[model samples]
Target: MWRGLRVALVRERFTVDGVAALIGSAARAALDRGETTPARRAVRAAGAAGALVRLFLLGDVLPRDEVAAALDPVDVDEAVTAGLLDVDETGVRAALDLRPHADAGLPDAPPWWVLSDLEVAPGGRTADREHVLGTGAASLSLARATVRRPVDTLLDVGTGCGVQVLHASGHARDLTATDVSTRALQIARVTFALSGLEVECLAGPWLEPVAGRRFDQIVSNPPFVPGPPHVEHVYRDAGLGGDGASALLVGRLPAHLTEGGVAQLLASWLITSDDWTGRPRAWLGEAAEAAAPGGLDAWVVQRDVADPALHVGTWLRDAGVDPASPEGTALSERWLDWLAEAGVHAIGFGFVTLRRTAPDVAGTVVCEDLRQSHDDPLGPEIEAWLDRTAWLAARSDEALLDERLLVPDTVALERGLVSTDEGWSPVAATLVRLDGPQWRHDVDELGVALLGGCRGHLPLRDLLDLLALAHGRDADELARTAVPVVRDLVRHGMLTAVA
Candidate 1:
């Protein structure tokens, strides 16, 4: 569908107006007339009414008028049922003037329509609507990872429209969905039923609904945006204190997982002054260790860190509350005050995929920022992280350092030589390109040039002697600098230390 037509046709008022009502009424009348399968008959009648509405709206005025003059019940029925005419501009304009609010009711965003094997507008939002279920980047990421795992019992926390629950049904034996919003639960129930999915639904906040329940896989797109205790509509805000909500969800997982159970979630948390890595680790560590005390192995990667104002604006925009409005302005103020009170300058957004962290089996959680497009519903790249084995905390500088080392011939020289605007010429290089996280070195041209020559055939001492003979520079000065450069290469895992 064209964007403009979609916008016009999708409003809840339009769905309920003249056409929808007429079709509904007509379907009821047909049912009374002994139509086979009343429900299907009603839908067909409603669809016909919608089609007629579309025709009068889309057709030319004089032509439609002539057609209307000659139109009989059969013609109207066929036109409405088969969509001979479209909902045109004039009809839409007239409908707009007729006070849709007085006639049809509340405004709404477009619905997800699967037409001719094509998905049209999966979901939409209106000006005042606070909650809507639509798959986002984070949600999609979670979905991809969840399907690949061999999970028996799947749990979707805060299952808005049960997107994750639906996705998980493909792999999970038994699926359970929990949410705080009753309205969302209603939509979710319908969504599951229509999709031919059967899920056990629970209504409660956070982990309250499924207390003491253990699952092989737990996936959540929780409300981790830190703000005041409002916006309970349930997509953006989780009414928990501090990182209370995020931590609460994280804190409880260990207890709810069987030996090797895995939990995947997308969350945001306040970044404090103390150790950034230690902060998230503290949640899985500490007194809660007994909860699932195999010692939860965590990989918490700080992706995009945002300051207070950015965090505030992010959620405010998500809520669809205009900052210019009085209520919007007040919301903004309250958010600023809350963030300020918490001493939160920036918040982090990323995935937290955890396992039971049992002692017998090493449970791992890898946190890394892999920015990529997961557009395909069933693509392999989406599950790459699920197969990730690297844990930053578990490995040492030596193990990390050793990764840079090469066995003889594979080592390559990579020099970075550039002149900045300030006329400072800096040239830097290594024995083998450093692969460590923190690659630090001085910009000494001769050091890079000399390191490039070491191929293990000529001893380092011979190269210095030749350079000393050619340039007549001090061999001692050249040799001294050479040792540090080689040491740095070895230290950073660029090259293995020669035995």
Candidate 2:
């Protein structure tokens, strides 16, 4: 039955591009905004694809004959028995949310189908505790940020509906998915089957099912929501106290990673004080110190932050609870009380990437706020970050000075000007990266001269000496001051070591 449905979907061109072409971009954009009227109108004249869209995407009930005609070779009774469709006196509707998804960053990649529970309508009843989610913002972000280099083995922890595994299938040799909810595992199995992929699904919380086993790569979109220590929805709540789920993964996942293995996960943490990095730094510090042989290198980027009130309201609506209603008011009060008592002033949402290092090597953990917009995939940037940091770590000041460096074209220098009595004068100079993370750094005249001289022609020591001579300063003192500055530039990809 799954094979027949797959064939029918492919034959009908029920894919991401196919659907967009049929409905137009406006209707597609509307569907993303949770308004299906435009899509319904656009697909009214479409054939089998239209029927499938109405039945599955728009949550509209179709006549039995139309469904039968759309899903040819796959008997309606078979589909019903397989729990893919539901029939009532009115007509037939989708029992699940099956839709086409592809990596927008990889245009050449083939489209894949995903199966999960349908979304709850606004003001409708809350979702089931065990509901599995399909492609959404969090999942898509993790997918886009994931490092996609080929690996021998990969693991997806808390694999709700197995969307991460679907993205990993192209680059990983062996795939394993683990979840705490059996229902989610079941849905993920069907998702894999429909996508024509094989994955080992294990039912257990976070890394328990794969104890003593190591993978070359691991990815997770864990239940990192911060709230009271109780489970209302299995997909978002870890049943642990505030932000414990994120801490748990950060501390434990290192032990299960092979040497040089990389793990990326979406996590949320609480902000009790002005120091947002305090919690994550402590978590990574403990984890890396206790790790075997080599420590763990962790990079955490805080993408968004929400205050306690806004956070509560956002999640309340997400669970299908109306915040204005009596129940919602009471729930909100309780949730806010917990957060207040815990001294959490805000909540931070972001991704963490950890890499296991070689034996006897110390690891580095960097935590920072990067709320800027990113126009490109972060996988390559992250990979480069790890490499650059490692290179800097292995070099001493003397060793680094002997190496030549060059700035790539992606790095741009910007000067801020202010109107003055005479003319527009430069108030500040800043170096900006045009690619990943788009970091900006304020620089002085010496910094500008140093960067301009780094053209892969001379060693850094020679450049520093020339700058000191030009500025009538001591070369040794200049080199001493420039060592840390150069390291920072290299770490942020503002400067590159010439090979």
Candidate 3:
């Protein structure tokens, strides 16, 4: 029956692109926004595909003849027996949403049929406690951020509907998915079975199911929504206090990671002070100290920050509750009160990547706000930057100054000019990376000249001599001043040396 259904979907082109084509992008987007009118109209025009979509995706009742004709090889009666449908004299309605999903970055991979809980309507009602989540923006974001390099084993924590586990199956030899909800594990079982793969779907909170074991990689899009203390849905609410789920997962990563292993997660942390870096800095310290080999490298990129009200409202809408209503207002007040009691000024949401470094490698933490759009599938870019950072951090000032450096093609040296009553004066120069993380570094004029002169043959000593001669500065003073700035460039991957 499953094979027949797969064939029917393939023959009908029932995929993400296909749906977008049938409904047009506007209506397709409307579906995401919980407006199904335009989508219903558009899917109706899609013929047999429309019938199948209506019966299965929209949870709409379709004519018996229409469903039979749409899925000829696949038995509709078998679908009913499997509890996928409830058919009557008039038509059929799906028990769940089974839809085609494909990752834009993973074009070589086949499109997946995802089955999970239904969405809440715009009128804003919350989901059931046992709700199993399907693919959403955050799910896809973690997918794109996940480093897809092949690994020996992967541990998927809080594997709701098994989206991350499914992706990890492609590159991981041994895959294990853990969740506290039994229903989630059941959904994960079906989700894995649909993908023609196998996984160990264990039942436990976080890593309790896989105690005393280390994984080459661990990926999770856990229940990270910060809300009031009372738990409504297991899929989004951790039942832990005030963003504790995120902190717990990140802090425990060190104990679960093998040497040089990496863990990535979509998390939100509370900011209790004016300095945004304070919270993550403390988390990194705990994670590193707890990790085996006693060192971990951390990169935390904050994508957005929501104040108390906005945070509560955004999550309320996510849970399908309208914030404008009396119930939603009360819920918001409770969550806000919780935040106030905890002394949380704002909530920082972002992607966190932690790596258990080799014994000789130094522990480091970098937390910064990058509140701008970025390219997807950033894993490779991030891995390369981490390697560069580790290499630069390992170098002493003398050792760093002794080596020749080359500026990458992606980096452009720009000079900032200040216009005043006097002629335009040079204020600053920066090395701007146009791709990847979009990093920029400030540099002095001599530093810029030295970086440009780095043709793989000139060392820092040679550059200092040239700069001192050109600017009439002492060589010793120039080296002392320019080396630190050059080191920063090296750390950020603007400057590099031959391997």
Q: Pick by TM-score: which candidate is best?
A: 2
User: Compared to the true structure, candidate 3 yields what TM-score?
Assistant: 0.91
Off by over 4 Å in 3: 1-4, 17-47, 72-74, 88-90, 121-124, 472-484
lDDT string for model 2 (1-499, tens) is 9889988888888999889998999999999998999999998988888998898889999999999989998999899999899999999999888999887656777668999987773348545898788887899889988998899999999999889998998899999999999999998998898788889999988888999999999999999999999999998899898999999998888888899899999999999999999899988976785467787889999999999999999988888888889999999999999999999999999999999998767787889788999867778888888899889878989999999999889999999899999999988899999888999989988999999999999999999999999999999999999999898889899999888
Number of the top-ranking candidate, with lDDT as the measure: 2
**Per-residue lDDT over 1-499 for candidate 1, one digit per residue giving the tens place of the 0 to 100 score:** 1232323334322433443464466654554464524435343334433333333322213234433432333343344343323335443111111111111111232232211100111232232223544555566656654535556798888887666775666568899998887756765665565345678999988888988788888889887777777665457766665676678777787677776567778777787775455456666664146444565544454546778887777666655556667877888888888888877777777667666655644445434543333234322322433333323233343343223223234445556658799875646654443222323445355655555555555556666667767777897777765655554454333444332
What would the TM-scores of all predictions be?
A: 0.56, 0.96, 0.91
**Quick one: how many clashes does candidate 2 have?**
0
Candidate 1: where is the Cα deviation over 4 Å? 1-130, 144-147, 286-291, 361-414, 418-499
User: Model 2 clash pairs?
Assistant: none
Query: Worst 10-residue stretch by lDDT in candidate 2?
Result: 118-127
lDDT of each: 0.54, 0.90, 0.81
Ranking by lDDT: 2, 3, 1
TM-score result, candidate 2: 0.96
